[model samples]
Target: MIDDIMSSIFESGIRGRYSFETFVLNLLKEHIAKQDKPFSTNEKNQKLGDGYAEFGFDRFTGPTIVDIKGKASKLTLISAAFGLSARLERACADIENLSNYIIVFGSRVSLEQRKLFDIQLAAKKVSVNKNVNVILWGLDDLDKLATKHKKKTKEIVDNIFSLRLEDAINKSTTDWISERDDLLLKLKSLYKDGQFSLFLGAGVSSSANMPNWEDLLNSLYVKYINNEFSDEGLIDESKISILADWLSSVNDTSTLMVARYLRKALLNGSSEDALFTDQITESLYSNIGDKANDGSPLLTSIVAMCLPKRRGAKVKSIVTYNFDDLLERQLEKSKIDYKCIFSEGVINSPDELPVYHVHGFLPKEKDSFDSIDRSTLVFSEEGYHYIYTNAYHWTNLVQLNSLRDSSCLMIGLSMTDPNLRRLLDISARSTETIKHYAFLRRLTANRILDKNHEEGRVVIEEEVISGLLKRHHTLSEELMKDLGVKVVWYEDHKDLPGILDSIVD
Candidate 1:
């Protein structure tokens, strides 16, 4: 039980320490001598401590300050110490008050370092006019608290998995929204003026049952590897799981490298020559299966933007990184005049909403639409190389023109692709007018910590997760600004449609 509790505590990110602290806070709430109730998180933050227990029910004698040190840097300790001291001093609370100061270190501390820190802590407590009882507890000491309160410990462990921090997280996430409303309003006002264009990415189609980039590449690798053209292949589809397992766990190669190899094998196969776009289309639709036509709210919002409500409103132009023709199909079903642009020389009429398929288009091949040129599909690693290396490539020119000329609102793009970022950077650096905008999701502890826990991976540093929770939004904002794209942050993917609706409403 001690091992289990401590394992979670050290699992990295804000999960372990925060969970334990909250658990301890709950225990204090049920304390026999607490001040009617537990200290609120807001109070804790104000005090620079996880919590300070105000024991002694009859008289309310004092505050037993509890500090949970997940990572005990000298600076952090000193800051906590001096900060607490200053806070107590400001309150004019009597020095040598009845309450004790408790410091819980989540990891091993060297005896020399522990003694030195303890002395400093003692001095701080004395300065605060506290009882001077400085209890510095290490990992083993933390176990005693859990071991002593077995039922409470179990409750805390269960609470961690159940996402007990949600209320606090929701509160923190909500605070960021109002400040971002101005940007959303600015964007909507521009859209009202017919000044904004849409730059859509894979994220828009994610909910429509399309595989992500990694999954798509992996699926293609599996399909091509088992093809009749391969010299050594998994012939029996019954053994597909084994093949997949090998690819997932045993294969150490990168996704792009594996994709490149698999694509080349299919291309050079002895049987029917497999076109890259056709292969992609097959893999894509296979994943989409029944959800091929079931568009996501994000997609619906984009489709709505393409055909505006107002009589004289200009139809919004779109530049998409996706290869799927869901957008084309959506527009077609609405009977909206829209042109699919994949070819270099293809010119869109002024009356038609232009949907540029910048990557390549191989929509469910059975669907009747524009005749796709095999050369136009940038569907393979080699294809990517061709466009990336060639400065004057048609795809480059198309994207560059859009980036340079339009105030494109980017959706579902991570901006990780160097080629895309390069184009964005170039356009941004060159222009002074019409800055771009993106809807960025703020990174929360729930994602990194909970995901790692769910995946059975060792949780990384708690401080890292906590620091990112506190700082990543600002950091991401600065990063996007560097690319000349202003960010409008949302809390979750589910919030995306609403964000889109807010801007387009």
Candidate 2:
């Protein structure tokens, strides 16, 4: 039982030596008392050492030099070995009668490492007299001694061991939300000072039935083919983007047409959809007039939590990669006035919040649908190349300026978009001043066990999934490092509103 307890403690790593040293001293005192010999703990004096071991008779064994150590890494162990060797030599030469040196470690040392220490000490050319000896007491040796005198020390060992075990278990099970209180505090500080902005991505709109990149492209393809393509045919859905690219080349048209189709479809319109002026106006009015419910709209709830309650307060700017007007609609509904800037323009009014649509927005005017501006939307390969090459582009300028000036909180962002990643990298390299933050969903393991399958097959499938998750986690860490962004992970998207609320509070 004692060996099992000691092994567990060793695996967990010893933290500090003060408590262990005090316990050892108390045990030594009790042992001396049982033998009817006087024992006194030497006062701590840096000039002398940690403590000294003294027996009443000088002839039996002179005062021993004592040192206590916690478990350490390989480099630390080497340093500890050399340091102890030097201390031993100095003490023996200065003290009156030091006969032995005793060192106690919280964990055992491997045989190879022990031999290395001995060799290092021998190389130091320290003289060893006939009466003096060096003693190393590891956990195993200490346990044996404590158990041999079981009646006196058993309670002390059990009490300390149990407390440490409970602490370890509690730490392992605690939620990350509780552990990251400091990060929350920092966010709140930034928000309160009005030096923070929000950079939103498609993830923020996913809850409102927004289509993802692939899904949006697939929808456009279906619409373009007039629903003639059979879903069961050899059409590979994964390659839909490539197909769109091919369509653009064949028709001698830009891929921006595809984006236009997608936006029109989202507004519940057909190819002849000229404008969404009516829908935009209705959405704007309804959101402003409607009372807050059980937070049915995720984006609106987040905006409400962030917006200042007092009238005429200046709101922080919001930058988004999404082309949809969801955030703008939410702001309008809350009666929080904002400027939607898709191109270069100054906000003449300081009271209204600025929403920079970096990727472009759907046309609000009737004629915009009839003659769409291909340069505004950044969806095609050529569009992305042009935007990135032109440093003075309005979208690039807004994103770079935001990164340089304020600490941004990126929400619903994957850090996977090439354009977004390139812009961040340029800012990080040029300025390297501000630290940005993001909220991501923590990756978790899934145990795959098909009840109808053979047991062996189930085990194999589980292992494969576990391996993939591990690799994904490693790659994610590398990407974050390159981007120089710190991420706070949550379990679910539903928790996002609460997280935003906590930051504001």
Candidate 3:
């Protein structure tokens, strides 16, 4: 029975498989829903749900679950167990209180394979203190699930599978198209209302071929070491890399550590601030010279939005986490009037755009602008500590004001920075509804199926992917909501320009 279902899913050109999906979704929904109140199938509820194919029930009233699996390879089983473990954790926080946990296979399980799965589950041993119950839903035990729960399977399967992949994807369960349309309208409204502020992160600079902070630190470290070793003879890049590996082996997230060392040693610490700034500025633009001036379509579109309209509201402020001057260079090329504000006493002139460099500024130091604030660069551990610990810091006030006052459109940001998250939290808590926006790609579920797209094969597996996307979208929206922002999701980065273009000028 399960064999036929799998065949229908992957090989058969039939939509009757929809029945199986409906059946499975229904079963899981029924099993996990609250008993007293109506349980919504909102795939996005993080506390009550997993990404897509899984559901997490509240332990207070939910039953002890015995997750049953169909016949699968060891790898597949292991993968499912890991997923189930996460889902179970979301449902029941206390594993020691978990009385029974079973794995029922639709096929036979060898002792070795059984041991393997036990070991896999034993991974929880670090947090789990009590023995877990395990039961097998063997071949004779698990036939009911896959055989067919509803009639008209053949007809439904034929109809669903008949549609071309593109058509199927557009009509997938997640319905991101409608959601995207809604987001665009909201963005346009914000832009027209003059409430939109732009927040840029490292991703924006990389598009122009600038090295990320970590890579910049790596390069700077290599150069600084070579200079220091000039008397003994300079070491090659490979040797510098080896030394770096030795230093960062213990902590994978040692970018800050590297930055701290460089801030202390490079250009002889803060005593030679001018030289340090020059070194960093040279490193940033040496390889990517004039490349950023060309500007990407995404960047161009962003710049267009910044241009003043004949009547409507225009971009008033821009805040970037990058230390490079790529955005400013583009603004200059486009002939848009903008000012770079990086210090305490400075502010943009009236009727001119303000580009706030909360991290610091290291422009190419063109003839027009000879002086810059090198001391404001926030790259090292000490710099971050200073800003985070000092609430009254000028940069903090600037960032806090951006979130607290306007509807910020964040691009090229990972949204993982704790400092940014803290600011967002404060902004969200302070306001009733901030309606800030950020662009993020989907992990497992977000899929873009463009009928007019000239590249790549048509996407299949609409049923599964859509389910996954629905969960992803919901959770992302909810998560960002807590941070006072709305999530604008794209399955592929290429779709970003088109989506951004949809925003009205």
Candidate 4:
């Protein structure tokens, strides 16, 4: 019996470590702790019962109350709903002490559960005559949080033996919603006046028929295998490029380590030293091409860029991290007078339409445009570090900051990528613009976590797309909220074109 109990405990511990709820809560806490004036959260007792409140002291803003929910079922994947009771109880328009914010955190909520939440909320509104600002943080929130903290946050989560939900609230994610809301409101105002720029990332591309990072890596692996390369003979294409680029520029210890990792990934058990030669790596390096690198979809992106503005209204400048000249191509085709900053043609002309590529680009030669070889693209850890350390890095950022100052309509991008978010954060700080919108493409209806625990069976789901709005229209309503940056989401990519056309018209 004791052995069984021990095994159960060990299994439970593992589940909590990898559970989605734990992952998100930790990330929230991590960011909150980094703020200039630390935010604080304390357990509060409301008329309904025990709830939580989050307050920010940095300056300006109201308090936020959070009612956290925990669960362990697949149906709870969509939204965290239980915390509403506590949040509703604590929610008051005028709090004597401070501003209030309400947040809900939990596993997931299924479709059926979401409907029930809506019905319950409606009943509460009709019978009790109270409006509660209940914010649901479910699977999508967890996924985004996990993606943002993939590196450092993962380590913290894996070793979260001492951390608890209460600990996270006090440490990282602030319960301060007024400031966040204010920033969002400012973004909305900017959109009304037509100002903002967007930094599209892989998440945006994912909505446009491109594979994600994991999918891209897997596809590359398959390509190698199909080309008659053995499993043990596999090599990371990005790593090879880094080595080739560094070797071509300046030789150092990094070059050796790069060569070793390439060797191990490729010819680990092989007796043929000839197979591990530089020529082999060079050949392998030629296979990589940025599918989004070309300007094939520039016209579409331009349409998106033009949609927010009135007829003939154009942004002061545009910037993208994409290697392809899609935006440039579109502008050229449309006779839009814009300078291609990524190309050698605009390298010395910083005053022209600024398009910066921090990671460099393909199709252009080194001396031809300040671009390095294809092998040197920032696709791997080594490649990223190189760009992260560039001398002109601050200048590139200053340009991005300029764009951030303008209200941006973000589309075709997932907010999950950590590096991308970091870039957004940098631009936000530089420009002091806190308002931005993100369009979510793939989202779960419900989720479950900590199934191994005794109290893990908590389930919550909310069907709140607003009055007269159904589940099908929830994304639209949520995206269109006037509080912050307004987001207009589509369930399918094909729908995006029509939506863009409508918005533009």
User: Scored by CA lDDT, what does every candidate get?
Assistant: 0.66, 0.60, 0.64, 0.43
Task: Please list the Cα RMSD from the true structure of every candidate, rounded to 1 decimal place.
Answer: 16.0, 17.7, 19.2, 18.2
Candidate 4: stretches off by over 4 Å: 1-194, 203-212, 222-301, 304-313, 343-352, 364-376, 389-400, 426-433, 442-490, 501-503
lDDT of 2 by residue, 258-291 (tens): 5554455544545433243333223323332333
Is 3 or 4 the stronger prediction by TM-score?
Answer: 3
lDDT of 1 by residue, 1-505 (tens): 5677666644443334445555555554444323364444445233445565555322235655666665565765565565656655543454235466666665655676666675676876636553445566665665655676778767766775343344244224435677688778888877777766788888987767788877787677677656652456536666664676576555457555666666676676544334655777888878667676778787787777777566544435788889887877778777788888887778888788888888877677545665575436565567788888999987888778776666779889887777888787777655422368887777777788889999999998978787666655655554565567777777788888877777767
**Residue-wise lDDT of candidate 4 within 1-505, one digit each (tens)?**
2122122222232132223333444555565556643433333343322233344422324454433444434233233333344434445533444343433334455566656666755654522213333344455555554565567565655555334433433332222234334444554455446555555555444443444544444333343333443345565555554444444344234433444444445455775544433323233223334433443242475445543244334454555554444455445555555554543334424334555554444332224433333323454455566555663564345444554566565655555444454555454333211255655453323322233234665444334312222332343322232123334444556555554444333
Using lDDT as the yardstick, the better of models 1 and 4 is 1
The clash tally of candidate 3 reads 7
Question: How well does candidate 1 score on lDDT at residue 300?
Answer: 82
State residue 350's C-alpha deviation in candidate 2, in Å. 1.2
Candidate 1 structure, TM-score to reference: 0.61
